[model samples]
Target: MSLSYAYLLTQMVIFIPAIESWLRADPHEVLIVTTIEWYERIKASLETVDDPRVIVHAIEVKSKRPGLIAGIQRTTTDHVVLLDDDSIWSLATLQGLLCGLSAGPRVAGVSNIKVNIRMTLPALAPDAPSMFEAMGAGRHDRRAATNTAMAYFCDSQITCYTSETTAYRTEALQRPGFVEHVVEDYWKGKCKLSSGDDGAITRLYQNGRKTGIVVHDECAIEPKSKENTDYLKQILQWSRSEVRQLVRDPYLLLPSHRRH
Candidate 1:
């Protein structure tokens, strides 16, 4: 299938293994979009990639949500797969995502199950390098529950978004209405927010009565250690965003309005 892979780079330094993953996937294009401030740094790192299919662009906008909009607007393929630069994926995972997205026309996007793999460093032997170690596989590698965002039992309708490698139909994204919403969205039409990426993207697929499917073999392997306070903080941030949706749908909290 002809589709583009959109990678969002937020850091100044490039993740080498992530670049390798996209190259190995060998999709129609590996479009890496980074923040404008880190454009030069990321561009310099792009030199290592000699493939003609790789395209690196900078998001001029100052915010995260708009940055994603820039990538969607640049995509030329009928389908585009969104990826996190910090996460690495197997070729099989990409195949499954594409298959799930293309299964039906009304299916706007497919959310892949993100498995967080705890990262650990092996200590080298002091005596000598491991004698038994002959060869090693490089260019590789979630311990999280709630792998995908499934509907909950609230008024028989409780849907949320997935923050993983998701495949979305390009046609749905090109609409004028959705693009405008991504550009600038305010909470309660009063407070301006700089973030709310997952919720906005979820609407991208779920908009127009379209359905977002949670089907996959497995998505990206995010090698991160939750052994520190930083992990807890990140989880808290996500919880806050997820809860923001519940704020709008107050009936989710009411047993009278909710279904069994």
Candidate 2:
């Protein structure tokens, strides 16, 4: 019953709470994966962790999809958590995600509400309903259909639900040659043309069933850099193309992209 988990970080600073929460929430073994440059940061971030089940490794991926594929190959755990430095989750949220993993194989992945870290302020704080607006959850934090891309506001209630910090079953991700395909797309510029990690995961989920939000509240994420605005837009367009190609395959195809 060991849950194998991988967390990915780029140029962003790591928040200690996220790691602390992962250590506490990990039902089994946990591994922290990051770029070679962040090795020291990963060690410093784990100072408070008392769990022996946690291990940290350095990966050389310079971009999102490749990093994720490397992390997945490194993990032998039954479950995996792909996360970013900016994505934060609580212990309770992680617990809920683990509980849902027992539901069976068709469930490829799960998302939480991811809010814009920079957008948090008293004056502009989001109410419960508005927080999940982009993700298509009703006021009650209801579950929408899985396997589709949905947007939720980056608020205190639920963050973006982007795979930057998502939980998945290893078999589901390993199937359909998930990591291999992502890497191929990366080399092909599909990953770069799309936004980044989110687009890569969206493409992955299109090949499988991405469950609705199960974690309590949501995870917080920062907005992309102003300098990378064009990059994000290109990522969006590339994501559309990748989804179309991936979904057309007979073995791994999802029903269709349902707009939430």
Candidate 3:
């Protein structure tokens, strides 16, 4: 049961913590993909680890999808786990995801549950809990409810699986259709997408040819928004991706295609 972990990097501070967690998980190999400019910096930062299993690949392309495709091409393991730099997982979580992939041959991928974390200003109000603390509490409750619905009412209806922390069988990803589904450009190549990788992959598995499962492990991810403008930009990008995907493949929005 060999596993390969692949992720793109932008900032050292965020990537270092994520790398630390991945090292603790002890995968067969770790694949880091980033721009050529940051390659040396990232390599230098990770040099103290002294682990031969870690491999870094620098690409000239600025898009995230191409880096991910390169990493997938380089993976030689039985399973590949695609992750985001902002997400962290436990060793047990990694084990659970691998176990899920072993359940069946048709299982294309397994996605773990995610909890959102946001930074808050606690210094402004010392007497009350920080916004981060309050939001964390609410997020957990919402996560519980979402998990319950997924387990009982919507297990077969789940169509979208997050790429932040997903494990896929190498064979499934090697399928010609799946590869094209992931790396294809939309809107006449005007948009080099940074988002919607998750949605695209989800559509492939939900197309009745394969299966995508949601595991019960906890995978924590930080919010993408640092300020109002950042949040708005993220929303706009996501909306554009969603619209483009719909135009490219309307079957994903159909009732039968989403019936698990």
Candidate 4:
């Protein structure tokens, strides 16, 4: 049987101009999960979409993890799309991501081939480093190294880390073990962590018994401000997350393609 699915947007409220066009292409249900503070406002935005299937859920947790955790918890569809707020998907992009998930029942999720908006141009303007975004982030979005890594994992039958926009089988996430981390993660079985949710989910699918397919060309991301200290802080947070992830699951260092 075909899988039933709904899009679950995280981190930001849905107001992107491009989203209207995207909905025109595939009017699938979209559920935006947010913190309690934005709940009423986000709930009101539901009227913005023509599709009645669209809905919003609110979690008391102030962290972004609540968006993902509460989002998956509220949906009963066979599949859930964990799409970020800053992502831009073309009319065909949503289908493209789903195509990867349709590979087989064993497939847990599908990762999008994400690119940065600066990539819309032939090349990044020479001085992008000083612009609103960091050069490495935009330049690496479609760099050869990233593509090669994806190819190696896909061809080698290894799971790729889904990011930016990914569609996951509901069962894959409903598993008790995976859900626990999403609810609240702990560092070294001691300190509690309410963040690094994106990293945690990626490591789960990448190292889990289930598998995933990588869509080589579809998703694009909005650039961040270089002037914003928030962006710099985010980078620092990611750095710490990497350390915790490696220790939590050493398999991340050399994940095996073979699954039991």
Clashes of each: 5, 14, 1, 1
Model 2 ranges off by over 4 Å: 1-13, 48-50, 115-121, 124-161, 186-195, 207-210, 215-260
Residues 97-169, candidate 3: write the lDDT tens digits: 7776777777778766654332243445655444434544354445445444543444433445555677888
TM-score of 4: 0.75
Residue pairs clashing, model 4:
132-226
The stretch of ten residues in a row with the least summed lDDT in candidate 3 is 219-228
Top-lDDT candidate index: 3
Model 3 misses residue 180 by how many Å?
3.0
Task: Give the residue spans of candidate 3 off by over 4 A.
Answer: 1-9, 117-157, 188-194, 213-232, 242-255, 258-260
**Which stretches of model 1 miss by more than 4 angstroms?**
1-14, 118-158, 213-220, 223-233, 250-260
* Residue pairs whose backbone atoms clash in candidate 1: 115-142, 116-142, 116-143, 117-142, 155-258
Q: Write the per-residue lDDT of candidate 1 for residues 66-92, one digit (tens) a residue.
A: 666777878888888766665566767
TM-score for all models, in order of appearance: 0.73, 0.60, 0.76, 0.75
lDDT of 2 by residue, 146-232 (tens): 222232321111212355456777776677666555655543444333234554555556433545455344432222222234534
Q: Please give the CA lDDT of all the candidate structures.
A: 0.56, 0.51, 0.63, 0.57
**Superposition TM-score, candidate 2 onto the true structure:** 0.60
> Which stretch of 10 consecutive residues in model 2 shows the poorest summed lDDT?
151-160
TM-score winner between candidates 1 and 3: 3
